[model samples]
Structures are given as structure tokens and as C-alpha cells.
Target: FNFLGYNVNVNSLLANPYCKYTECCNDDWIKFRRNRLMRNLTNHVYGQPLLQHAVDALTSHFNPNFQNHKALVLSFHGMTGTGKNYVSNFIADSLYINGVKSKYVHHFIGRLHFPDESKIPQYKEYLYNNLKAAIKDCPRQLFIFDEVDKTPPEVLNSIKPMVDYRDDVDGVNYSEAVFIFLSNIGADVIREHFHDLYFEKGRQREDLQMIDFEFLIQKGAFNEKGGLFHGDIIANSLIDHYIPFLPLQEEHVKKCILNEFQIRNVNLPKPEHVEHVLKFVEWGPDESLLFAKTGCKRLSSKVALLVDKYYRHESRIHNEL
Candidate 1:
């Protein structure tokens, strides 16, 4: 069969592990550079001072000297547009050659994949079998589960055993494997905590640490009405870190606007261009210590409108979408 202009055997491809993980293993293979990932985070990602901790967690977990005690589990909690999904994809891009599209990366959405609560039993079986095969094939596989708060506890049961702190699970070692769970369960709490610290207590954003918001996230995940809180994953302390993403401010939005304009390579955006885009953004926290309601999620569309209105003089190629 011809795949991407190369003839290949489908059976042989499936039989082998998905890209054995290092250049030394295969000269043509992609490798992970700790510096590259750190640089990407430092340059592309904005706001969220707590984000710095992720650099250490990811690098240390994937280190070659690390033991195969169990899989690396990271639970990301925050509001929309807070870089949860963005950071998740960055991790994939940093780890695998094909980035998020890599065959080794498996992404699942709770609402879409599971859906019917009544079918959770079957879903559990299906999830288990799929994961078992993938992990057996490549212990370094990456699994991303989005909308975890919407997923039911019974459905999440499928992943508990594989991610647990067991050295050998039926002869399979998942030390190099990674599991990322993204959810909006603790958005309100995180924002409120930040607001109170900055406004009520007169504490600066830079001074706040993970401890300030972590307990709130833990409280939400444990008490919230979602699959994340319903299971023993938290009680058993299976998750490595509960990474929190705070709300984005107007300055951060301005930076995103500038970055987007730069990426398009059309007419350069001016001060007015940024001001025009900011009008469309929703700010909250009662106008005191304002934060973006949707973070950077709506910037792309708003910027598209900005370009169409003013920069339409610049011709776009037919192939450009």
C-alpha cells in the first residue's frame, strides 16, 4: 500500500511500536529536546505564572534515568482559553515527531466518545481493550482525555488500573506512558482565588504560588459533579500534578493579538488594530482585576474579522483557507 507516497506493509507497521522514541534508536526518528520545549513555553505561552512548574514535571518524568514505576498522569484544571489544550498539544509536539497528529498520540473527549451513560459498561470494556493494545505495543503512548468533568466515573474506570502506581501490570510496564486529563471543573475557584488574593488581600500575582490555588482545585475535583471527582484517582493520589491555569488579562490578550497578526504576514497590526480587537473580548471579575472571559479562544475569529475589515486589500492565495 502507498502511504504518504511511500509503499509499506500495513501489518508490519501495526505490529511494531510507534516510532521507538529516540534518534539513537532510529536515525530518521524525531527526538525530544528539553530546551526546545522550555523555549516554546517561555515564548508562545503567556500569563499563568504557575505554568513554570510544568517544565520541571514533564522533563523529569520523561528523563531516561526515571524508573518505570507507573505512568505519568497530569490533570489540568482551569477555565476556557487558559492554555489547557494548548499546553497539552505543546507536550505532544515536544514529545513526538508528528506532534499531536502522531499515531502514538490518542485523544478522547468524554462527551463525544462516551456520551450515553447507560452504555458506560461497554465503554469501559472498549476503552480497556483499546488502551491495553496501545500500551502493549508502545509503552510510551500518550493519551489525552478532554472534558473529563463531563465523563462519568464508571466510564473512567477503564484507565485507573493502567495509570496506577504498579510496577508490572500483567507484564506491561507503563513508566514512559503519559496521561493528560483536561477539565473546567475548577475554573471558577481558581479565578475567584486569584481575584481575592490580588484585590481583597492585596497580594501580587507574582507572589502567589501553586499552594494558593491547588487546594481549591483539589476541593473542586473531589466535590464536583464529574467523573474526575467520582473515582479514587484522587483519594489514591494517582495523579502526579493538578496543574492550574489562571485567567488571561488584557495585556496577555494584546500579546496574543500581536502574535496572531505577525503569523498572518499581511499588513502589520497597529495600536488601533489591537484596540479594535479588544472591544470584542469579554472581561470579567466585575471590572476589578479584569480577566478574559474566554481567554484566547475568541481571538482568532476576532482577528480574522479585523483583517477582513481593514487588511482585505492584501490578496490571499486561493489555496489559503
Candidate 2:
């Protein structure tokens, strides 16, 4: 079946979705495994200290009873490749057995799904029906909206019925669902805030709290002509947490390169090899903390170049023998 640009399979997931709504079967799909998600997020996601708050929010929302009054709405604000999507995937992996690919998980990119701003009316109706249907079919649903900044403001109101403070919209409770909105709206604000905390204020970035940033990103999002701009999504206070994702600095970039090496199953890169990847990365904001311009966006390609060169050199030495 086709639902919101994704193909849905009505196999075990649909026919027997009993495990999703309860703890009886002990199955993994949409089961809130707090410790597993926490461990993975702690280990895999790099340079995102704010994620600590996210962890707190998630754990609290998904208590033992797993009773949420409304959909757990997390609005992620950051630049591209700053672990926004990565963290979202980790969340999916933690909650669902099949992760992002699970029929329960519905990821929509604004640019791809609702590209034409003029068609906001049509997009709104289409999204409204899909979301309502998905929630009814499987309450343990995860809806990730990527590139949210590109989606029309009117189109987002389609989400109001699901995220609002209501027990049920015609008997379907949205409390068991999740809605993640990812954007690059307030990345610079976060970067500047971090710089002040680290340098002028001489405070540790680690010491910063959600209170310091939660509002800044929200304000930026409201002011910016993007996802949350003039939308009831913010005015009505539908978003639970305005999680700010900071831009990656040099140290984090180095870590990303090393992490990328491990991901590719390549040899542990030597110091020089790591430096080579660093050299290709552009860093600035000039006179500031010098965070990566693209925040590890093109890192995979750069790491690939190093890996290919290493293999080629190894082959030459083997042939020499």
C-alpha cells in the first residue's frame, strides 16, 4: 500500500501489531528501550552536548507505562550534517526494531514531498489524511520531517490535530506517536551562543543547559521565514522541546573523520591521514570558534579519498614483493 510517498507492507508488522501497543510480546518494534537508545546516542553521536537534554526528555516521555498525553514533538534546530539526522536515526533504532525502514517510521523531507509552496493546500490535506490513517493503524508511529524549513508554513498546521493537547481525535490517541522536525534554522545562533560560553564567558560548553538555548532557537525559528515561521505549530505551543543542535568544531570534525574511518571498516587512520581529511574541511565564522562550515556534511567523500589512496598504496607494495 502507498502512504505518503512510502510503500507500506502489511506483513507481521501490520497484521500483528499487538506488540507495538503493549509489553506482552516483548518484541522490539516500537518498544521504548531506553537504555539501548541512550547507549547508542552516547557512543555514536559526536559533539552534541545538548543531546543530554534530549535524552532526558525522551526517557521522561517514554516512561514504563509509556503514557504520553500527546505526541512527543521534538523540533531539532541545527545546520546540515551536525548529527540532526544521525540522532533522529538513533531514536528510530532505539524505538523500532526495523529502525528508519520500519513501516511504523514515516520520514518526510519538505523539499521532496512538499516542494511547491503554491500547493500548500493540497499538501496539507494529503499529509493530514496519511498521518491520521497511520496513527489509527499503528499508534506506535514515528514521523520524521526533514528539511522542515522548506515546507510551507500552512502545510505544518496539518500536524496540529495530532500534536495538540487532546485525549483523542475521534478515538485515535496520538500520545503513542512521535513527530520530529529537523531544520537548519538556528544553527548560527547556536554557534554564536557556544562561542560566547566557551570564550568570552569562559564557561564550558559541557556546562550549558537547555534553558540557555531552548528559547534562542525557538525565537530564531519564529523569526526566520522557514518551518516554524508564523505557523500555529509554534504559536499554539505544539512543539514539546525546541532542541538546539550546535555546529561541529575542529575537534568534532577530527572525531567525525576517525568515526567515518571506522564506519567504512577501513584501517585505523594514521595521524597524517586524519590531518589530510582535516585539510580538506573548511572552518570559520572568522574570529570565532572556527566550526566546520558544512559541519561534517561532505566528510564521507573526503574519508573515502583517503581510504582509496591507502588501498592503492598497499596494492603497489604487495606487487613490488
Candidate 3:
């Protein structure tokens, strides 16, 4: 895909992990940056508790023997369109702007096969060697596996050693990279499989919970003894989880918009522009085409075009009806 006419060879880049990471991984890609963090905190959409916990988790890694903490594993499981991706990006951006170096690696994990596994021992052998090298000089690295549930059992099993501490005789210092797993798995599914319940009713409150079903299954606890389910063990292995809710009042959204405009070096649009954009948002997928067309046009013009097109189309439809 060409990003603003920049010919991007995705396949070749993906093959080169380091190059792929550098190309796509940048703090600016996230909506919230250092310039916007403090302002965002006041207008935080998800409240402060979960965000604070994430900061604490990242900071704790600075301590010695932090490697023993089992790879700062965070599982973000929720319904679609719940800002899981946004919050993850925000966390990554925040750490980066603070001068914390982290190697961000995001993989879809569709089938979870080792990149090169023609020979049985070859893939595992390569992984072990790589892990050893990573340990030699711990560079802050984050391994993000998005849609972990989509990965095949074989691929998931391959990563097990990396997720936990393992002995390496000859290799690098110690693989001290953090592992982050993001999934759209239904909370009710996790609860039923682990907690042996039917559904996840609205709690009216946000507190993170991790129920261990896969652990029980591996330990031979099943049927009457315990909820021995082998379904998605990684979900059970959650080091941390957060439910991000948009608790922002109207004023908060306005503040965020203004802050975003300022940090982006773009002039804030008039009130009418904001109204037009909001209407376009309400229109959803239909307005997506407009954003795609506008590219880097002025925000004011984009909003005006969006409003004009929407009303024009609506008038036509009404006349036809």
C-alpha cells in the first residue's frame, strides 16, 4: 500500500523484523503524546486507576530482579470498538516519549507458525538462540501479539518458553522483553470457560479480573473437580487487564479535540466544523470514504465537505422517496 504516494513494500518489510518495527512503530502514530498526556489525564476517558496501574507496571521493571516478574504480560480482552487498540498505543507512546526505549513488535498471530519452520528443530533452535542473544544486553522490548486467540495451538505453544523464564547455556544476556497480548475475546466466554458461568452481566463498575481455566485444565482438574477447560490459556495467564470506558463529559471531548488540534500543529476549527465532524461520526462508515478522500486537507474544509455531502445526499434521497 502507498502511504501518501510512498511506495511501501509490506511483504519485504515484514520479512525484516527490525526494519518493519522501525517503519511502523513511532510515538506520533498514537493519538496521545507527551504534549497531550497531562491534558488527557484531566479529561481521561477511562478514569485514572487502570492508567496508573500500567504506569506502575512499566516503572517497576526498572528495579533489579524485575525479570523474575514473568514478562509484564497484559491481556486486553473486551468487545469490539472498546478502545483496546487505542489504549495500547497510548501506553506505548507514553513510555517512548519519556525516553524509555522499547522494541515494539506487533503480530496478528493468524496461524502462529514460526516464521521459518521447514525443519522441526530449526525454528525452536533459532528461537532459543535469539532469546539468548536478547538476554545478553536487555534492550526494553515489547512483544505484542494481537488477536492471540486466532493463533493455532502449535504457534501458541512455541511462544510458551519465551513468555516465562528459561535457562540458556550459551547465548545473549537474558530475554527481558515484555509480552503484551491483545484480544477481542468476549469476557463472557472467558468467564464461562473458567468461572463456569453463562454470561458477563454489566457490572456497572470497572475492575479488572483474571479467571484461570487453562491452568486448571493443564493440572488435570476437570468436570466436577474444577473448571478444567483448555480454551485460550493465554487469557487465563493475564498479568494485567483493564476495561477502558469513555466516561468523558461533553466538555472533556471538546478539550481533547482542542488539545489534539494544538499538538498536531493544526488550527482549531470553528464550532460549525466540530458540529459537522460530529454529524459525520454519527454517519459512521459512509463518512469513512470522505476521510480517505481528503487525505491531508485542512480539517475545516474536510468537515465542511462532510456536512455538505451528507445533506446533499439526504436531500436527494428524500426527493426520490
**Candidate whose lDDT is highest:** 2
After aligning candidate 1 to the native by TM-score, how far in Å is the CA of 94 from where it should be?
0.6
Candidate 1 regions with alpha-carbon error over 4 angstroms: 1-30, 286-289, 312-321
Global lDDT of model 2? 0.83
Give the count of colliding residue pairs in each prediction: 0, 0, 7
| Colliding pairs, model 3 | 132-172, 133-172, 135-173, 135-174, 136-172, 136-173, 136-174
Q: Please report the TM-score between candidate 2 and the true structure.
A: 0.87
Error of 1 at 188 (Å): 1.2
Give the whole-model CA lDDT for all candidates, comma-separated: 0.81, 0.83, 0.43
Candidate 3 TM-score versus the reference: 0.49
TM-score of each: 0.86, 0.87, 0.49
- For model 1, how does the per-residue alpha-carbon lDDT over 170-286 read when each residue is reduced to its tens digit? 777777788999999888998888888887999877677888887789889988888887687877778888888988888888888887776665536778888988888888867
Question: Among these predicted structures, which one has the highest TM-score?
Answer: 2
Which portions of model 2 miss their true places by more than 4 Å? Answer: 1-28, 287-289, 312-321
lDDT digits (tens) for residues 214-296 of candidate 2: 88988898889886798898999889998888878888888888888876665567899899888888777875537888888
Give the 10-residue window scoring lowest on summed lDDT in candidate 1: 21-30
Estimate the overall C-alpha local distance difference test score of candidate 1: 0.81
Clash pairs, candidate 2, are none
lDDT of 3 by residue, 1-321 (tens): 999989998876656466444533332322224435444444543322335444555556535555543556665554343345556666665545432234443434443544433543655455455554544434345556566555433444455655555443343322445566655444334323422221244332234332232333223311212111243334355343343222222333344444444433334445774554544222112532211111121334444454455445543554576
